[model samples]
Target chain A: MDSSKVKVVTCIAPVNIAVIKYWGKSDENLIIPINDSLSGTLSMDFMCAKTTIIASPELQENTFWLNGKEQSFNNKRLTNCLQEVKRLASKSLPHLNWKFSIKSENNFPTAAGLASSAAGYACLVSALAKLYEIEDNVSFIARMGSGSACRSMYGGWVLWCKGSSPDGRDSIAKQIAPASHWPEMRVLILVVNDERKKYSSTDAMKRSVETSELLKYRANQIVPKMTKACIEAIQKKDFEIFAEITMKESNSIHAICQDTYPPCVYLNDTSHTVANAVHAYNEFKSSNKVAYTYDAGPNAVLYLLDSSVDEFMSVINYLFPPQDTAEYYKGLPLSSNQLSQDLKMALNIPVQEPGCLKYIIHTKIGEGPKILTDPQQHLL
Target chain B: MDSSKVKVVTCIAPVNIAVIKYWGKSDENLIIPINDSLSGTLSMDFMCAKTTIIASPELQENTFWLNGKEQSFNNKRLTNCLQEVKRLASKSLPHLNWKFSIKSENNFPTAAGLASSAAGYACLVSALAKLYEIEDNVSFIARMGSGSACRSMYGGWVLWCKGSSPDGRDSIAKQIAPASHWPEMRVLILVVNDERKKYSSTDAMKRSVETSELLKYRANQIVPKMTKACIEAIQKKDFEIFAEITMKESNSIHAICQDTYPPCVYLNDTSHTVANAVHAYNEFKSSNKVAYTYDAGPNAVLYLLDSSVDEFMSVINYLFPPQDTAEYYKGLPLSSNQLSQDLKMALNIPVQEPGCLKYIIHTKIGEGPKILTDPQQHLL
Candidate 1:
């Protein structure tokens, strides 16, 4: 085995925003929710995690940098993720023995509720799998880090099994549809300011563990039904069904967050602006077809048909002139009139009498995660 | 039965903010939610809708004014409420007859979560009941206008019933605990900037009408349990239980809103701020428990115990410091260190600092709807 040669493995995974949200976790230890949720993965280059793992003798300790912040290497979750990847990697490359250093960051914003970590860890696991040529399943590895990270393993539509497996070994994300299955679908990512959340995902989950009971009911009744709906929607390429499920599931997850005693963290107004903007655009769009879903943060990941691109762009330009619009729109609900009123006053980046998404991508359906061997380049 | 020597009787009702939320519609047409929701009649100095009911034999039309804009008099729901009130009034005053004219205005700094109309109609019924000297209970008349607004008929801690009646006739607002019941209880009304809601309460109700199965589930499962919890909390004057129920119910209603097919509106950062502010206060003042709940709009109605007012004040002053602390706490999620970072960059307002709430009220509790025979001056 050529395992002794310096080994560097990198993995990439996309984020998934629950349409049927997983807001409250009943069992924090296992990351078991009280409800079953439905979510859709965004088909964009921006919303994902890219990770690099190096097993080297020179590095004396297991250390890391996340999004460039040299964070405490002691986080149990990160440790768990690293351990899982190494164990799997070791199975295939047993001769490689050394200290490991992993660096991870999200292409998308982290923890405003969109599931960056899910994608981040998923990619982390997958990337290591690729780097070491591990035979262990990717979902199995990602699950050890975060519950929903496993869902990030697939591209189009994925489902996380709230499997009854006591240790959560069987609970993993399964792809319901491949990205090639729906080539016409489009997702518009609105990075609502990259503010770090008040309560980290872990803290909020811990709160839900103690307070919410509806969460328990949700995990049981609603989630099961949502999973089935997700399968049926993507199979038929039914946007209406997919969108409806996506929105409802996310809402439900947010609801659980709201209901979780002492309350859980959620996306703010600017985040809400994304929801309203998407809603207005969908209403006014010719197909009335766009769908929106959010992760833990306020950023909105909207999916639409290609025909509505121009209209989506026009509406976004009108609603969010990009700078202060994100500020004004953050504290208020998006009204059709507010767009015009906002345009009248916004001079920072040109009236943006017609605005633009920070950057718009004309992406079609997508495949699962892919490694980027180069820097300063879009995925080819 | 000379309905009045004067041709018309004019009246207005202040919109009540739910310190404890009334969420989930048990009877959609009736606007009844599952729990026995609780609220404060706010200081009413500013947040009020004025309505005048004029009777004239020569009048040829009926009209309604919302913030000076004329609305079509023919909406079915409005008609249902008006007719219901008149029917009740006529039963008491058999010969009182004249074409009725109504004018209304909301002194709200923000658009009502559309709770204004609920208050207006409830007040319309209340004022008319007094003017016409109706024999039927005000509760009965209030119900005709808006099921929940009926609770506003009386000040202090009010409750609206989500009873099991097919015709929705039994659903009425009742006083479980008055403001006077707990003289030390205080409500801090955090008025987020007033912008019209993206979805009107009317449109939201329609969405709930068409797509919300969870609305039904809530009414059947969650609300009933919560209603009982609310009653017990009020009876015992237990702030912890009261706060728990208030917040839970609010989230439940919001959850149903999420379940709506097209989805619905929500609070932004400022709203999130009010919530996080209360939470931060709770964290600092573990003994001086203050809890908050939001209705349909972004306005935060927080419940504070008389015993812990000072701690709440200090926390409010600190988290939302009079000038920039070391954070940005104002926009949303007041509990986060990032907010602290933002607060560091911005000016923070202390509680002792002027202009925190639109205006703080020192009143303890007040009685149900009352008429001012001498209208020289009135806060209500």
Candidate 2:
């Protein structure tokens, strides 16, 4: 990548959730996953990130900004992504001359489990691709940002190739089916707050690769099987297989995390509370209509059918009702004072007075990208 | 239960090496192994142990004898095994009033990965069963001694039940199809000389249980499927699947050991050198007729067909020669030392200047138990 010489390029992108889940990587530097992974891109309306890049003589080095605050972009892993994207863009736009500056921000919580970087990088690459108009296209550029980000260049159900190509050019993401293919597939974003990361995904993955034979097995057996099921579920619009695969793969990943030395401390009590409730609800009904997956944070992303919205919300409402409902919900959603008073009382989590969940949005599935002409919008 | 009983019975039994390996334990304390681990009971002709139990009113305290020398049996785990066996015998025959003096010795090294204890315990239980004519049966008696010892009672080919029963009474070892059933199965043991164990099998297994998700996957997925194949292969005289499963499971066990924190080291260079040769031979050939499995020690037991003895021997014959092989065969035997001077010079191993391997015992599979009661022997 030419360190000097750049103009203005901007992009907007949406987050993605792994449907099959990618727990282990084969090549750390190359970011080649052990097996093919399937993911669902979030809608532009709810979760998105915007990124802009500028070139000038002032910058002695590349600088990064998130939500207008200067942030370190010196991390080799992140820098690798930037350098690759720049490499591709500069190859074609050879005469371009200027130092580069990057500004990006996630609309949602920065440190949250939601894949803000997937969106952030997707937007960054798309903007550069547009500015450079290089032959490699958005996906070719997106692949440099993050393996999953390539999928964000497309809308709806996207499949990232667990590509065998050494260069990773062919490992770019492509749409399996459009978002409209299963728009009724809804995700109830469960927000569980936590602090910053203790282990970066790269470091954690490396640890797992070195120390976990279970990871090797997953890479060889479980993930491949799950990826197939996920793709088939999307294509056939089969929510049953979709839900089963999603839930199992998530559990498998969390299990791998737990299998690590000194283990990953990603989840919290609230997350477990939400998970247990969902599990209870599903097990009681004897149906696989809903499934939940969580990421590096405590928050969960619950995939439910359009038909189960009322029942799901009822469970949530029972757990976290308005402040005035305390008298009726005696045995549930106990406060700290009440919990101390009654040990037998079960926890409903978040112990909300009101609006205690951070926030809950009931949203349906949608496409990956959207163009917001008005740049100064309501975002982080 | 009586710690003050001077009539303590001590037995030093040899451990059995599985021709068909056992990997997972269904019940921990009961030593109920998941699959039937098959093995041969090497003759007391080459190596055997002598144990005598004397119970009298004159004795004062309970003690143990290892290799004819008095030793402390205060170690909880060892004491527990002895106590349990004694309790079972005493419970069965309350009328036998005798204070027992116990003495034990092994003609060969004990617990150096030849499964000396498994053999010794089984033999101990056998002798005890004979002494009291305990109607509870020798299998039951052996189970009380050690989990694997139960299998040691009749050693042609045995299956240690991964007993589902909670009390574990049903977990006694059973004769699958004795060595007589498959006389064509040949075992060439390659013992490697690494005096110190990096970790005991007990510790390694516990580590695997706690730290290894790989073990769970193997136990849950691989073993179950492999076990069925093994039983079928044995019944149908199918050598291919039998060999493949044995080697894979052994390798998987070793892999789990390597994945342990501070890792459990198993194979030394000598061990790997033999393994590499075997692997290369198998890979180079159009058909793989031979397979190898190792126990806690570096000893590699090569299982092959009777017809392939010459080829197998030729390939590994260099490891054991035509002379007094037993003297050259140190506690841990490396194959390269048995090679001709020319071949030994070409190879880098524990290859000394002269013949070093124990004379190869070329034998076919045979029956388990024989009762020879000559009048003179019986009187003695």
Docking quality (DockQ) for each candidate: 0.42, 0.05
Candidate 1 chain A weakest ten by summed lDDT: A347-356
How would you encode candidate 2's per-residue C-alpha lDDT over A200-307 as one tens digit per residue?
A: 776777777775556778788667767887888889988877887786676666556644532453655456556656665666567776788877666788888777
TM-scores, one per candidate: 0.77, 0.51
Residue lDDT tens for model 1, B269-345: 55666666666555544532776667676667667765655545544555443443332122212222233444323
**RMSD to true structure for each model, in Å:** 7.6, 16.5
Against the unseen true structure, what C-alpha lDDT does each candidate score?
Answer: 0.61, 0.61
How much does candidate 2 score in TM-score?
Answer: 0.51
Best by DockQ: 1
